[model samples]
Target: MKVRHYILLVLVLFTGTLFAADIRFTASVSKTEVGTGEPFEITFSVNANIERFGAPAFNGFQVVSGPNQSSSMTSINGNTSMSMSLSYDLVGVKEGEYTIGPATIVAGGKTYHSNAVKIKVVKGRAVQQNTQSPSAGGNAPAVSSAPSADLSKSLFIKAVASKTNVYQGEQITVSYKLYTSVNLVDNALDKLPDFNGFWSQEIKNNSQRVDWTIENYKGVSYHVATLKQIILFPERSGNLVLDPLSMTFLVRRAVASNDIFDQMFGGGSYQDEKYKASSAPVTIHVKPLPENGKPADFQGAVGTFAIQTAVDKSSLKANEALNYTVKVTGAGNLKLLNAPKMNFPEGMEKYDPKVTDNILESEKGVTGSREYKFLLIPRKEGNYTIAPMKFSYFNPATQRYMSLSSEPYTIKVAKGDPGTNVTAFSGANEQEANLLKKDIAGIKTGAPDLYKDEEAFYGSVGYWLLILIGPLAFIGARLFRKQQAENNKDQVKLKWKNANKIAAKHLAIAGKQLQAGDKKAFYEAVYKGLYGYLSDKLNISAADLNQQNIAEQLQLRQVDAVLISRLTDTLNLCEMARYAPVTGISEQEVFDKARSIINDIETHA
Candidate 1:
């Protein structure tokens, strides 16, 4: 009876597990084809309770009203189940084919992404762009045909640069501020400016929360949030255009009373409308640094700085360690400054300097100091003098180049132990032998030992061990051959076993291509590596495999959703880079990401 009970309990648990794994979270649209200005419904529903849900960005459509949460519970024959859904009413705003990306949800302590939905928008009847409607005609106020103009003026992002005209390598500040008069229901950043042709340093606040304040722009009061603050230094001289920052905002707009109760109470209702706000592109006119007064040794530093040098000790024994430091203190692109040149006397070994920065950024500008420490070793005893260090920078504030000279350092080196070995500097090959004195003794002077065998080779221990190796080798070879034969019997299993090797071979090719500066071949090899890995590991044919089935197969194997997503993204990037123009992600980066995804899949799945 106990055995039967255990068996029954095990069966019940197994069935419950299967049922739990059957949770279906899917996205469906009312119409796959529609006309421009026609509104449609898209619903994301799941059979099980979810913890978090994220709606996909509606790129080519305007959300009239969205994400209405509805839940229902049912019980039949003592079995209860619950389901929830979030639906959005979106209208096509552009006449083109578009795809709505996947929506994500967290359930059962795991996240899942729904399949993408595609929509085709064609020309439709002209719709009036009215912003208001009479409430007496209907319970709800009709949505305007055009929401961009209405929401753009209320909620938008403004990219503000401190100064547009400046010399190359001059420091400037650019801030992307979100100004809003309407209540923001939700928001997400779409794209950040690439900021090409410039070196950018973003100012990060201590807190993750946005600091909101009331600000009046163009005589209109609005709540503003500084989204991103960046400090940029132009790398070249041209009319460089600062790309726009794009974001999507769900705004709550005051609409006519949508309910009979609200209409009777003389109250207004609000509708959540989705609108995308892209900051206007700002052009910065960068001027070349003046060449007339520029110093010959200037290292492209455009800032005001003060240099100070110090030596740890002016006198030291030969082969002793010495610490020399150079510090530059002041503000204006201190982070961009290069290492100052040092002129140490002969017979001393100098090393690369260790750089340290103490920088602070504020509204006024960047202000801080940078320090470089150099390590030196004197090998011979003599009186040596280090030339006075010189650092020149083009100060945009003064509109001229200036140079600073540090006091010279004179050192007296006393001889120590002759056994100490100091490597020669530069190409002094003849002096190298004298400088390199090893502490250990030279090669053995006596002749090598050679003796006749004391015992017969037939009965020695080595002879017995060697005799045993022949039988062991034969047995090992036999077993390996048999195992290979069995593996060959099942081609599928062989492919599965060799999946990792095949991917690695392709990755090796991709690495070679990356070093050779072959973008096309590099991307192709990376794409093949990832896809071939998936094909062999998942038993899916490469030609027939698409993103949808790949995702499904990975999920069936119980791979983590996040890892699957990463694999998909890498595959997409590799494929896209093969044909289209992919920026911000380099070929090496794509290769690394692909290799990492394959490794992770092997590790986890």
Candidate 2:
């Protein structure tokens, strides 16, 4: 009886083992060994009731195409089971023998893995070509909700600039153009690049819809549209990079469906596909203008231009004011060009000139007119000549220095009011004037006006009370609103308000770890805590905080240079200790340095 019981127990245990391991995963490759530049498929077939599934990270080989997924469910013997599969087309960028991983996924609260496989990629193909690959994690093609046609192979974009090299403060115009050889069904923007290290002004964009023109590019005819235009002025002389612009478009393609019979029955189907591409980034080398041959009146203006002046009334009464208008207009650096200074005669009271800009940007360059209106009041009646206004600019097209001067204007003033008479006081010297007023006594003290000083009101009490209370009430209300905002602040608001304070707390924790001789934990704590603090303080993501990005952002915020360098050095030291495994740095030294760095950054930032 005991032997029988043992046999039954063994059978039960074996059956349970099979039942527990029911979830199965199988993987297969289209070709195990292929020549270089050859494409093949790797499919992972999952046969189980999967509640959730995740893909494995692919390394060592490029993914030419992606995980096109197909799933199905089947019912057999009143028992249901689901199956799903994903296939990827991969290409080898380099020849090597690579071992793929035992990829794992979780299903039904249990982890299942696919078997490891070896692949041999050989070189010496007939054709030399570059391989295209999908991005990591097998991101699928983006689909658009709007109905549109595909323009992947027919349309493209390019950016054109007026000049690559320019002096500091000189203007440069950059225009984005779209060239289309085929009709576009629809297009939309994916991302807009950032403009760094320059002052930028958007001159034209989609907001202003202009007519499209048919133009020939590289001897090929196409419809061109000016997508965007900007006028940029470099603040510093260096290599300024203009980032790339990307867009996604949906396009329609005609595909043959079924057979002749289906076409006759009007059963043909058309499909729309989407493609995304980015324009190449442009780098410009800005050369500073030579200071040796520089003109003193050169206000950093470049390109060819013209200046003109017109007077509303050249002849007028002595006391009456006349308008002298100067309009400077032409194509070139209009915004950077400076207006000529006006020279007024003695005894003329001239108010500030009202200057207005009416500039428009085009593919050629920046074109505009600057009008300077000067109001001149002549003190004496005589014939006075106002010198011509001069404007100077460097003509890049002509490759020479060009200047323009308006013709001088003569104003005739007749004798009028004694205040405006120049001859009346021409012969009288300052000494004579002092002698004539020698007998006049200086200002004398006098009693105040008693009746004017007294307040006038029908009801003194009400008027004085209202006058004193209105301003007080307004002050009290403002104070109450400020208190309410402070009291109602949530955690996010409080974090932003005292971000530096919280960062100091974490830095202190890192310092303690350093004191305990925990070098690895110390560096990890300092780097992560400090960076995380900055992310919270600056409201930036950790993924985007590289050295250039951090420096650019902090410099724009007017952060001090010493603090920036200290923070950069501290981060570098942490990385070196982790990666290089050089002579181990002292924990106490790094701790103090980290504390000081954080303090300095917070103080300056």
Q: Model 1 TM-score?
A: 0.51
lDDT against the true structure, each candidate: 0.76, 0.65
lDDT of 2 by residue, 1-605 (tens): 57679999999999899787667797888789977556677778887644345666656666644555444333322234556776776766578898777767656447888887778989845322232211111222332222234354356777888888776556788877766654345556666655555555555321212346768877866666666676776645678787877776555545568789768886666666766766777887876655555565565567667888888887877767787898888876565444456677775645556567798866555678878877677767798888898777776555456667889988898767654432233234444355457555788687743453336664688787988799999999999999988776665556656767776776776777667765555666676666777766666654455555677878988998887887777776664443222243566777788777766767676
Show model 1 residue runs off by greater than 4 Å: 1-149, 258-268, 421-605
lDDT of 2 at 227: 60
Q: Clashes per prediction?
A: 0, 5
- Model 2 alpha-carbon drift over 4 Å, by segment: 1-155, 162-173, 179-185, 197-226, 231-236, 254-256, 263-267, 356-360, 381-383, 418-605
Q: Residue pairs in steric clash, candidate 2?
A: 149-250, 149-251, 149-252, 150-251, 150-252
TM-score against truth, every candidate? 0.51, 0.42
Work out how many backbone clashes candidate 1 has.
Answer: 0
The local distance difference test score of model 2 is: 0.65
RMSD of each: 22.8, 30.0
lDDT of 1 by residue, 435-464 (tens): 455436688887766667656787889989
